[model samples]
Target: MYLEKIDAPQDLRGLTTEQLRALADEIREALLRKLSAHGGHIGPNLGMVEATIALHRVFDSPKDKIIYDVSHQSYVHKMLTGRREAFLDPADYDEVSGYTNPQESEHDHFTIGHTSTSVSLACGLAKARDLRGGSENVIAVIGDGSLSGGEAYEGLSNAGEAGTNLIVVVNDNEMSIAENHGGLYANLRELRESDGKAPCNFFRALGLDYLYVKEGNDIEALTAAFRQVKDTPRPVVVHIRTLKGKGYAPAERQKERFHWGMPFDLATGEPKAAGGGEDYCDLTGRFLLERMRTQPELVAITSGTPAVMGFTPERRREAGRQLVDVGIAEEHAVALASGIAKAGGRPVYGVYSTFIQRCYDQLSQDLCINGNPAVIAVFMGTAAGMNDATHLGFFDIPLLANIPNLVYLAPTCAEEYFAMLDWAIRQREHPVAVRVPGAAVVHRPGPFDTEYGELNRYRVERRGREVAILALGSFHALGEETADRLKTEAGIDATLVNPRYITGLDEELLEELLRDHRAVVTLEDGSLDGGFGEKIARRYGPTPMRVLNYGLRKEFADRYDLGELLRANRLTGEQIAEDVLRIVR
Candidate 1:
C-alpha cells in the first residue's frame, strides 16, 4: 500500500519515520519478488533502498543529476521514477535494465556498468552545467570499492584542484565485488569508527571538503546531510557507512557471498543449486593456484572479480603467498604485473575480458613493448554471445593481437587452457595471452607446444568432401555438433576445423582445407566486422573459400540468455548445420 501511494518523492513528505521504514520493507519485498522470478543484482539493490529513497526525498532528480557508479544499485531509483509496474510484471522485466540507462529515464544520466567512473563523469556534467549558465546539483553515488580505482582518484584530484561544485557520495558498505582492499578502506573504517570526528582525512588531503554519516540507513539524517550540501560551491565527499544486504539476515552474514548472486530462496536467502557444477573459472583458478605453489616466483592478480574467477577469500588466504587483489584498479594491476615480470618474476593477471579494456595502454606499452613475458589470463574472452555491446569481450583478441611481441592463445576447452597456462609459464620469450572460452567442456588433449606459432593452426574434427566449418574456441563444439547433425539428418559430411589462435592464422591448415573443401564457414562469438572471420577472408583472398562469417553484429546487444543469443546469431549446432546444408546444396 505504501509503495503504491509513492508515485513520486513528494508522496513521502507526509509519512512518519515508521511509515518510511515500512516503505523500505515494501521495496525489499518487491525486489525479492522480481529477483526470484528474473535473476539480477538482488542484494545490492535491496541494501540501497532506504538510502535511495532518502536521496530522492532530498534532491530533485532530472534537475539534480545523480550518477551511480556501476549502476546495479539503481533499481529503486527506476521504481520511483514511474517504472514500478515493470518491476511487478515478469514479462516486462526487459522494460528497465539492471544498470542505469539514460534512454530509460531522464533521471538516469550516464550508462555506466564499469566501476569508479562516476566522479569523472559527474565533474564533467557539473562543468557543462556551469558553462550553460544553469544551476543544477551534480551528485555521484560511488561505492567504497570504486574509490580504489586510479581513475576515481584522478577525478577527485581534478575536482579538488578546480574547485568544482560537485557532491561525491561514497556508499561505504565495506565491499567491492568481494571485500574491499587497499589503504583507502582503512581510512574509511577510521572515519566510521570516529563518528566523522577523525583528524586524519583522505579527502581533505586532496583539498576537498568532507562529511561523514555514521548511519546511512537513517532517512532523516541522510536527507539533512543532502540539504546541508545542496548549494555548496566547492566539491565535497559524503562518507556514508552502511551495511551490504542490510535487511536480509543471510546476506548480512555472508556479505561477500550475496554481493552478486543467482536466483535464490527468499525464506533462507540461499541460491538454488543448479545441477551441473565446475565452472570454467573454477578450473582456471585451481590450475593457477597449483602452478603458483610449485613456481614461487609466480604472482596472480585480479581487478575486483576474484570470486567470479573462482578465487574466493578462502582460496586467497590458502594461496596468499603470491595473490594480489588490486581492488577495482585494473590499470594499476596491469602495470604492476608488467613490473613484476620485468624483474624476472612470473606475474599472471587474471581478469574478466570486458574489464581488461581499461588497461590497453599498460598492455601495449608496459608489457608488449618491453616483452615482459607476463602471462595474461583473459577469462570470458568471447562474451558468451549473451552480453550486450557494453559487456562484449570480443575486442580483446583483436586489440592484443595487433600489439607487437604479444602471442595470443585461444583454447577450445579447460584441458587446453591448463596446457596453455603451463606452456605460457615456461616460455620467457615474449608476452603471452591465454584466452579462456566461456564454458568448461571436456575435449581430448592434443599436442600443445609453447613455441609461439605452433598452436595457430586449425584442428580437424571431421574430414569431408565439399564444405569446411572454421570454428574458434567454444564454437568448435558447435561445429562438431553441426557435423554430427549433417551426417544424421542432411546426409552432408562437412569438415570441422578448430582454429586455436585468432591472431596467428594457421596458414598451413587453411591451405590444406581450401585445397580439399569447397566452401568455408567461419564462426566466432565476437563482432562480425574485423573479427577472426574477416581475418580469414583477408588471408586467403578471393579463392573458392566463399567465407560466410557468423558472429555478433555491430550493435549494442541487450541482456539475454547465452544460448538464445547463439541461436539468434545462427551459431547454435542445429542452426549451423541447417546453414551448411543450404550452402552445400
Candidate 2:
C-alpha cells in the first residue's frame, strides 16, 4: 500500500520514517520476485534500496541532480522516480533498462552504463550550473570499486578545486564486478574502519572535504548525512559504508554471484535454466592455469572483471601468483600488460568487449606504440552478446582495428582461438588482440592450420565461382550457411572465406577472388560504418569488382530480439544469399 501510493519523491517526503522502512521492504520484495523471473543486477539493487529512498526523500529530482557511476545500482532510484511499475509489475519488467538513461526520465541526467564516470559527469553538471549561475544540488553517487579507476581520480582531483556546490556520495559496497583490488582499496578500508577519521585519507589527499557514515543502510542516518551537505559550497566526499547485498541472505553470503546473476530461485539461489557446454570463460581459465605452469613468465591480467576470462574465485586461487586484478582500471591494465611484455614477461589482459573501450587510448599508445608482445583477449565481441546501447560490443572494430601496430585477430572457433592465443604470447613482433566469437564453439571437421603465424592471411574454407563471402569472426558460420543456401537455392557454388585477421585486409586473397569472383560479399557482426566490411568495400572501390558489405547499421539498438536484429540488418543466411545472388547479376 505504501509503495502503490508512492508515484514520485514528493510522495515519499510525506511518509514517516517507519512508512519509508515499509516502502523499502516492499521494493526489495518486488526486486526479488521480478529478478527471480527476469534476472537483473540483484545484489546492487537490493543493497541500494535504503540509500536511494533516503536520496529521493532528501533531494528534489530534476532540480537536484544525482549521477550514478555505471548506474547498475539505479533500479532503486528508478522506483522513486515515477518508474516504479517497471520493477513492481512483472508485465512492465521489459519497460526499463538495467542502467540509467536520460531518455527514460528527467530524473536520470546521464545515460551512464560504464563504471568510474560519475564524479567527472557530476563535475560537468555542477560546472554548467555554475556558469549559468544556477543554484541546484549536484550529487555523484559512485562506488568503492569505481575509486580504483584513473578517471575517478581525475574527476575527484578536479572536483576538489571546482570551488562550487558538489556532493560526492561514495557508496562503499566493498565490491566491484569482483572482489576489490589495488592499494586504493586498502586506504578505503582504513577510512571505513576509522569512520572517516583516517589521518591519511585518499579523498582528503585529493583536497576534497570528507565525512563518514558507518551506517549507510540506515535511512535515517543517510537522510541526516545528505541534509548536512545539501547546499554546501565546494565539493565534499561523503564516504558511507554499506552492505552489498543487504536484505537477501543468499546474495549477502555470495556477494559476487549475486552482484549480477541469472534468473534464480530466491529460496535456493539456484539458476532456473543453467547453461552447460564449453564457454570461452571456463576455457580461457583452464588454458591460463596450464599456460602459467608451463611458462613461469606468463601473467594473466583483468580489470576488476575476472569473470570475462572465466577466472572465478577458485580459478584465481589456482592462478595464485600468475593473476593480476588491476581493480576497475582498464587503462592501468593495458599499460601494465605493456610493461610486463616489455620486461620479458608475457602478459595477457582479458577484458569484456564493452569494458575494453575504457582503455582505447592506452591500447593505441602504451601497448601498440611500444609494439609490445601483449595479448588482449576481447570477450563478448558480437551482436548477439550485449544488447545494451552503452555496452554493445559491435563497435570494437572501429575502436581497435583502426589503430596501427596492432594485429586484431578474429577466431572462427575454439581451436583457432587457442592457436591464436598461443601465437600472440610467443611472438615478440607486435601487440595482438583476439576477438572471441560470441557464437557457439565449433571444433570443425579438420585440424586448424598450425601456420597461423602469417599475419593478414585469410583461410579459404570452400572456394567457388561468381560470389565470394568473406565472413569475419562470428559471422563465419553465417557465411557457411549462406554459401550452402546459395548452392541449393540459386544453383551457384559460392566461395566461403574466413577472414581471421580483422586489422588488415588480405590484399592477396581479395585480388585472387577478383580473378574468378565477379562480386565479393563481406559479412561481419558489427556496425557497417567504420568497420571491417567498410574497409573491404573501400579496398575494392576503385576496382572492377563489386563488394557488398552486410552488417548492423550504425545506431544503438536496445534490448532487441536477436533473430529480428539479424533479419532487420539483412544478416541472416537466406537474406544474405538472396542479396549475393542479386550482386552476382
Candidate 3:
C-alpha cells in the first residue's frame, strides 16, 4: 500500500527505513507479478531493490548521473523514477524497457545493454561535466563480470590518469552469466576476507581510490559508504559484495541459474520454464564435447558464457575438452583461438553473436590475415526483440563478409548447425564463421550435398511460379508457413527458398527463380541497411524483379513481444503471405 502511493524518488526520501523496507517488499511483489505474466530478468532486479533505493536516497539522479552497466538491474531504478505504474499494470508493459533507456526517463542516463561499457561511457561523461564547469557526481555501476573486460580496466586507468571525480561501483555477486574466471576473483576474495583493508588492491593498482563494502544490501551502511565518497574528487572503486538473488531463497541457492532469468513462483521461488524446449546452446556444447574426444587437438573457448552454452566444469571434464574461459576479454579470446590454430590445434571459439563485435580488429588482423583455420560459432545471430539495439546481431553479416579467406555459413536448423560444426573442425583452408539463429528446430534434413559457398540457393520448401520467397536462417520456417497460408487463404502459390549462406548471392539460383517468378521476396532477421537483402537488391537492380526486403529497420529496436517484432519487420508468415499476394496481383 505504501508503494502504491509512491510514484517518484522524492516519495522514498520522506519514508523511514521501515517504510522503505516495506516498500522494497512491495516492489519485489510487483516484479514477481510482471515476470510471472511475461518473462524477464527477475534475479538481478530482485537483488538490487534495497541497493537502488539507498543510492537514489543518497544521490540525486538526473542531476547526478548513474550509468548502469548492462542496465538489466535498472528495473528497480525505473520504478523509483516516476515509472511505478508501468510495473504494476500489465497492459502498460511496453511503457518502460527491460534495460536502461534515456528516452524512457531522465533518471536513465544511457541506453545500455552490452556488458563492460559503463566505465568508459561514465569517464567520458565525467570529463564532459568538468569541461562544462558542472560538479554533478558521475557514478558508473558495473557488475563483477564486467570488471574482467579489458575495456573497463582501460577506462579505469584513464579515469585515474585524468583525476576525474567518478564513482565506480563494482556489484560483485561472484557470477558472470557463468561462474567468474580470471585472477581478479582471487583479489576480490582478498578484499572480502580482509574486510576492506587488503594490502594489494586492484583498484589502487590502477591509481584509483579503493573502498570495499562487504554488506551491500544493508541500506544504512550503503548510504554511509556513498556519502563518504560523494565529494572525493577522484576516481574511486566501491567494491560492494551482494548476493545475486539476495532476498529470494531460490536465487540465492542456485547462483548462476538465477543470474538472469524468467518468471518463477514468488512464494516457492521455483522458475517456470518459459517454453518447454531444449536449449540450442546446450546442443552445441554437447556436440562440441563429443567432438573434442578422439580429436585431441580440438579445444573450446568462451569469453564468459561457458555455462550458458552448457560447457560447465563437469561437462568439460567428462568430455576431456580443453576449455579456456578468458573472462570478459573478447579480443583475447579471438587472438587466443588464432594462437591455438597456429600450434596445429583446432580451436573453436563460441560466443554470443552480439559480444563478438568487440573483437572485430583481432578477427581481421590476428586470425584472418594470418590465415589460421579456426571455427567461430556465433550463437543467437539475429533474434528480434530478445535484445536492444546495443545487443543486436545486425552487423555480423557485413562485418564477417569483408574478411578475406573467411567462410561464413548461417544454419536454419539445429541439425545443420551440428553438421556445420563438424565441417568447420575438419576445415584446414581458412577460418570459418557459423551464424546460428535463435529458436531453431531440431529437424534433421537430408544430406547438405553441397560444399561451402554454394551461394544463395533456395531451400525450395514449396514450388510456385507467381511469387518466390527467399528466406535466410530462421526466416525459412516463416517462409514455408507463408507459402502454405497463401495456398489456403488467398488462392496463391508461393515458392520458398532458404539461403544457408548470406555473404555471396547465388547468382545461378537467382537467375533460375527470376526467369519464372513474377516477384521475389527476401526475408532476413538482421538490419535492412547493408544486410543480406540489400546485397540482393544491388545485384539484380531494376529488371522487372520486384524485390521486397523484409528485415529489421535502421533504428534502435528496444524490447517488445517477439511476435510483434517479427510482424513490425514484415517477417511473420501471415504478413509475408499478404505482402506476396499484394505484389503478385
Candidate 4:
C-alpha cells in the first residue's frame, strides 16, 4: 500500500498524483478503522486528509513550520509523519493523543487543543524566523469553525500588518461543532458561494492576500494553491472549501454528532457501546427547555460548544431564539451573558471548565465587577473530566473561586444542582457560577433549598467529634466513604460536612467545628493549590485547628488514568481515613 511505503512528508515528495490519491484513500480507511474502535475527533480529521497531504507534499515540516489550530484534525498529519503504525495497528491506537503534541514528534510544532490559536502562534513563529534570518515557510492551518474566535481575528490582523512570510490556511468546513454562528461565518459562506472572488473578503479586509480553492479535497488543486504562495514575502490566506466528514456517509449526514465520537460500528457508524442511563448533559437540556417555556426572557448561551449545556440541534430548535451559540468564543459568551443579565434578561452561560479559562477577564471585569446575576453553569470541573493536559477541568476552582463578587457553588447531586441553577437564574445579586457535577449524574432523593441569599453557609451531613471531614461538591461521596472507613476501621466517628459554596467559607460552621473536631480534613476534586481545600487550610492558619487539604497537586496531568491520578493524590476514602487516624493518634 502507498501508506505502508510512505513514512514521512519527504516520502510523499516522490509519489505520483495517482499514488497520492491512493495514499489519501488508505489514510481515510486507516482513520475510519482506528476511530471506529477508539473514540476521537471524527469529522475534523476525515475532512482534513487531503489538505494535510497537499501540505506535507508542498512544505518541509519541522523546517517549514505548520501549526494546526486546536489540532483536532492533526490525526491525518500524525499518520503521515512516521506515526501511521498507531492508526494501522489496534495495539498502538492509544499511542498518540487526540490533539497535536510537540513531545510526540518534531513535526508537531505545538501541543494545542483549544481553538483560534494557530494563526497567532504561527505569527510568533514567523516573527522569530524573520528576526533570526531564517527563511522557512510558516503556515497556520485553522478551521472547523475556529474563525469565529476573537483571537483568530487578532492573529489575522497581526499577520496582515506584519507582511512577513506567513501562510494562513483557512480550512472551511462550514461547521463549528454545531452549525456555524456569527457574522464571520456569513462572509465565509459568501466566499464559498462566490469562489473566493467576493468583493468583501474577511481575510482580504484584514489586509492579507487571499486565494480560494473550491475543491479543497482535491490534492492537485490544493498543491498548486500552496505552491503559488510558498515563499511569499507577505502574509496570505489560502481559503479552501472542504466537506466535513468527507468520506463517511453517516458522519457526513450527522456532522455535529460525528465531530467528536465514541467507539462506533465501522459498517453502520452506530456507537459500539450504548450510553449509560442518565447524564448531566441531557438533564441540563431538559430542565432549561422547561424553564424557557415559562420564562420568555430566559436565554441560554454557549461558547461554540452547545452540547456541553445539553442543547443539541433539536433541543436548540425547540429553544429557538432563547438559545445562543457564540462559536468558539468563550470570552464573548461570558460578556454577552453579562450584557443579557444587565439588560434584565435572565442569561445562563453553559460552558466547560477548560473553556471558561478564556473568559477570566470577562468574568471579573465585565460580569463580576458589575455584579450582574449571570448564571454560569460550569461543566466538567473535576479530576474525572477530560484528562488531556490542555483540557484539564480541575483548574477552574482556582480560576473562578478567587474572583471577587463571583459566587461559585458546588452541588453534590442533580437535585441540588438544578436548585442552585434555578436560584442563580432568578437571583439579582452577585454573579453566580454553579460547578455542575463532573462525575456520573448523581441523583439524591431529597428537598434542596431553592433560595441562596445568604452565602458561605456549609451544610452538615453528619455530626461527630475528634475528626471533621469537609467534602466539597463531587468529593462529598468520598467524604461519606471516609466517614464509613473511620467508623469501621479506625473506630472514630468523623464529622461529615458538605461545603456547598467554593468562593467563601462557612465561618459559623467552621468555628463550631473547632469545639469537638480535632483535625479538619478538606476534600476537593480539583487542584489543591488555591482551591477549596487551600481556602479551608488558610481559614485555620491562625487557629489551633489542624486542617488537612486533600486534592490534586499543582501540575498538568496529560491523558492520565483517573484511578492512578486519584491514588497518587491520595484522594481515595481509604487514603483520607488513614491520614485522619494519624492526625487523631
Candidate 5:
C-alpha cells in the first residue's frame, strides 16, 4: 500500500497526484474498517480524507500548526501523522481517541472536542508565533456547522482584524449534526454558487481576505487553494466546499445517523449492536410529539444535537413548524427559549449536560432572572462513562444548582422524568431544568405526581429507621439497593429517600430524618465538590447528624469505567453498605 511507504507529511511531499489519490482511498477504507469495529465519527472523517491530504502536503505540519475545529474530523490527520497502525490493527483501535489530542503526537496541536473553538485557539497561536518573531502558518479548520455558535462568530470577528499569518479553513460540508441552520447556511450556499466571488461574503465582511474551492474533495484544487494562502501576511479564509460523507454510500445517504455511530456493519452500515427498548430518548420524543400537536404555542428546541431530545430527523419533520434547531448555538437556544416563554410560548429546550455549560449566562440571566417557564432537559449528567475530557456531564449540577430562580429537578425513573416535564411546561413561575439519567435507563409504572407545583420537596420511597439513604436523581436505585443491603446484612432496614429536586434543600423532610436515622448517607451521580451530596452534608454539619457523602471527587475522570468509578467513590450499594455497617457497629 502507498500508506505503508509514508510515515509522515514529509514523505507525502514527494508523492504524485496518483499516489495521493490512492492514499486517500486507503485512508477511507481504514476509517470505515476502524469505525465498523469500534464506533467513531465516521462521516466527518470520510469526507475530510482528500482535504486533509492536501493540507498535509501543502504545509509543514509540526512547524505550521493546523488546529481542527471540534477535531471530530481529525481521524485522517491522525492516520497521516504516524498513527496509521492505530486504524488498521484491531488490537490498536483503543490506542487513540477519535478526536485530536496533542498527547498522541506533535502534529496534533490541541486537544479539541467541542465546537466553535479552533478559530479563537488558532488566533492565540498565531499571536504567540508573531510575538516570538517566528514565521509559521497557523491554520484553523472550522466546519460550517460549528459557525452557528456565537463563539465561532466572535473568533471570526477577531481573526478578520488579526493582521498576521493565519489561515481559517471553513470546511463547508453543508451539515452540522443535522442539516445546517440559520441565515449563514444561506450565505454559504450563495458563496458556493458564486465560486468565492459572492458580493456579501461573511468572511470578507469580517475584513479577512477570502478564497473558495468549488471541489473541496479534488486533491489538485485543495492543494492549489492551500498553496495560494501559504505564508500569507494577514489572516485569510480558504472556504472549501466538501461532501460530508464523501466516499461511503451509506454514510452519504444518511449523514446525521452516521455522524457519530456505535460499532456498525461495514456491508450495510447498520449498527452491530441491537438498541434497547423505549429508552428516555424515545419517551421524550413521543411526549413532545403529542405535546406539540396539542399545544400550538409549544416549541421544542435543540442546538444541533437532535439525538439529545430523541428528535430524530423523522421527529423533527413530525414536529414540523414547532421544532426549532438553532444549530450549534447553545447560548442562543437558551436565550431563544427564554424569549419564547416570555412571549407566552411554551418552549422545551433539550440539551446535553456537557453542552449546557456553554449557556450558563443565558440560563442565569435570560431564563432564570426573568423567571420564564422554559423546560431544559439535561442529558448525560452523570460523573462516569463519558468518553472525552472536554465533554464531562458531572459539573452541570455545581454550575446549575447554584443559580437562583432555576428549579433543577432530578427524576428517579422514566415516569418521573415525564411528570417533571409536564409540570415544567404547565408552570409559569420558574425556569425548570431536568437532569436526565445517563446510561441506566430504569422505568417504573411511576404514575408520579404531576404535582410538582410545590418546590424543594423529597419523596420517601422505602421508609425505615436508624440509617437514611438520600439518593438524588439517578442514584435512587442505588439508594434502594443500599437500603436492602442494610436490611439483609446488618439487620437494619435503612430509609430510602429520593431527593427529586436538586437546586433546593428539602429542609422539612431532612429535619424529619434526624429523629429515627442514626446516620445519613447522601449518594449522587455527580462530583462531591459543590454537588447535591455536599449540600446535604453541609446542611447536616451544624447538627449531630452523621452524614456520609458518596460521590465522585472533584477531578476530570477521562474515559472511566462505570463499575470501577462507583467502587472507587464507594458509590456502589455494597460499598456504601459496608461503610454504613462499620460506622454503626
Candidate 6:
C-alpha cells in the first residue's frame, strides 16, 4: 500500500521515517516476487533497496542527476521513479530492462549495463552543469566491485581535481561478480574496519573529500549522509558498507548465486529448473583442470567472472593459485596473461566475449604484438548469447579477428573447442583466442586436429558444386540445414565447408570453390560488418563468384528473441537456400 501510494521521489519526501521503512519492505517483497518468477539481478537490487529509498527521499532526482554504475542494482530506483509496475505486476515484468535506461525514465540518466562507468559519466554531467551555470547536484552510485575497474579510478581522479559539485556514493558490498580481488580491496577493508576514520584513505589520496556511513542498510543513516553532502561544492566519495543480499536469507547465504539468478523457488531459494545438462562452461572447466594436472606452470585467469570458465568455488579451490581472478579488470587480465606467457608460463584467460571487448588495446599491443602464446577462451561469442546492447557477444569476432598475429579459432563443436584450447596453451607461436561455441553443447564424433601451427585450412564437410556454404563456428548447424534444404527443395547438392579459423581465409579452398561454385554463402553467428563473412566476400570480389554474407547487422539488439532475430536477418535455412538457388540456378 505504501509503495502503490508513492509514484515518484517527491512522494517519498512526505513519508515519515517509519513510513519509509515500510515502503522499503514493500519494495523488497515486490522484488522477490518478480525475481522469483522473472529472474534478474537479485542480490544487488536487494542490497540497494534502502540506499535507493534513502536516495529518493533525500535528492530531487531529475533536477539533481544520479547515475548508477552497471545499473543492475537500479531496480529499486526504478520502483520509486514511476516504473514500479514492472516489478509489482507480473504482466509488466518484461517492460523495463535489468539495467538503468534514460529512455525508460528521466530519473535513469544513463543506459549503463557495464561496470565502473558511472563516476566518469557523472563527472561529465557535473562539468556540463557548471558550464551552463546550473546548480543541480551530480551523484555517481558506484560500488558492487566497480571500483576495481581502471575507468573508475580515472573518473575519481578527474572528479578530485575538477573542483566541482559531485557526490560519489560507494556502495561497498564487499563483492564484485565474485569475491573482490586486487590490492585496492585491502584498502577498502581497512576503511570499512576503521569506519572511514583510517588515516590511509584511497579517496582522499585522489584529492576527493571522503565520508563513511557504516550502517549503509539503515535508511535514516543513509538519508542523513546524503543530506550532509546534498549541495557540497567539491567532489566527495561517500563510502557505505552494506550487505550484498540483505533482505532474503537465501541470497544472504549464497551471495554470488543470487547476484544474478534464473527463475527460482521463492520458499526454498532453489532454481525452478535445476541445471543438469552439460554446458560449454562446465566442459571447459573440466578440460582445463585435467590439463593443469600434468602442466605445473599452467594458470587460468578471469577478470571477475570465474563461472564463465566453469570454475565454481570448489573448482577454483582445487586449482588454488593456478586460477587467478583479476576482479573486473579485463585490461589487466589480458596484460597479465601476456606477461605469464612471455615468462614461459602457460596462461589461459577465460572471459565472456562481451567483457573481452574492454581489452582490445591490450589484445593488440600487449599480447598480439608481443606474440605471447596466451590462450583466451571466449565465451558467448554468438548471436544467441546475452541480448543486451551493452553486453552484445556477436561483435567480438570483428574486435579480435582483425588484430594481427592473433589466431581466432571458431570451434564447430565441443571436441574441436578443447583441441583448440589444448593447442593454444601448448603452442608458443602466437596469441590464440578460441570462440567457444555459444549454442547447444554439440559433440561431434571425430578426432580434431590438436596442432594448428598451419593456419587457415578450411575443412570441407560435404563436397558439391555451384554453392559453397562456408559455415563458421555455431552457424555450422544452420549451414547443414541450408544444404539439406538445397538438396530436398531445390534438387541441388551444395558444398558444406567448416571454416575453423576466423582471422584468415584459406586461399586454396577459396580458389577451389571458385572453379566450380557460382555463389559462396558465408554463415557466421556474428556481425556482417568487418566479421568472418566480410573477409570471404572480399576474397571473391574481383572474380565471377557471388558471395552472400549472412549474419546479424551492425547494430545493437536488446533483449531480442533468437528466432525472431534470425528470421529478421534472413538467417533461416529456407531463406539462405532460396537466396543460394536464385544466385546459382
Q: Candidate 6's residue-wise lDDT over 462-581, tens digit each?
A: 999888899999988999999999999988889999999999989988998888889999998998999998998888889999999999999989999989999999999999988888
lDDT of 2 by residue, 196-250 (tens): 8889998888878888999999999999999999999878988888899888999
Better of 5 and 6 by TM-score: 6
Estimate, for each residue in 100-194, the C-alpha lDDT of model 3 and write its tens digit: 98888888888888778999999999999999999999999998488888888888989889887999988888787677888988898888999
> What lDDT would each prediction earn against the true structure?
0.80, 0.89, 0.80, 0.92, 0.88, 0.92
**What is the Cα-based TM-score of model 3?**
0.90
The true-versus-predicted C-alpha distance at residue 206 of model 6, in Å, is 0.6
Cand. 5 Cα-lDDT: 0.88
Error of 1 at 162 (Å): 2.7
- Superposed on all Cα atoms, model 3 deviates from the true structure by an RMSD in Å of 3.0
Q: After superposition, how far is residue 31 of candidate 1 from its true place, in Å?
A: 2.2
Q: Tell how far residue 352 is off in model 1, in angstroms.
A: 1.3
Each prediction's TM-score versus the true structure: 0.94, 0.98, 0.90, 0.99, 0.98, 0.99
Native-referenced Cα lDDT, model 3: 0.80
Clashing pairs in 3: 456-506, 459-498
After aligning candidate 4 to the native by TM-score, how far in Å is the CA of 376 from where it should be? 0.3
Backbone clashes per model, in order?
0, 0, 2, 0, 1, 0
Q: In model 4, which regions exceed 4 Å deviation?
A: none
- Candidate 5 is scored at a TM of 0.98
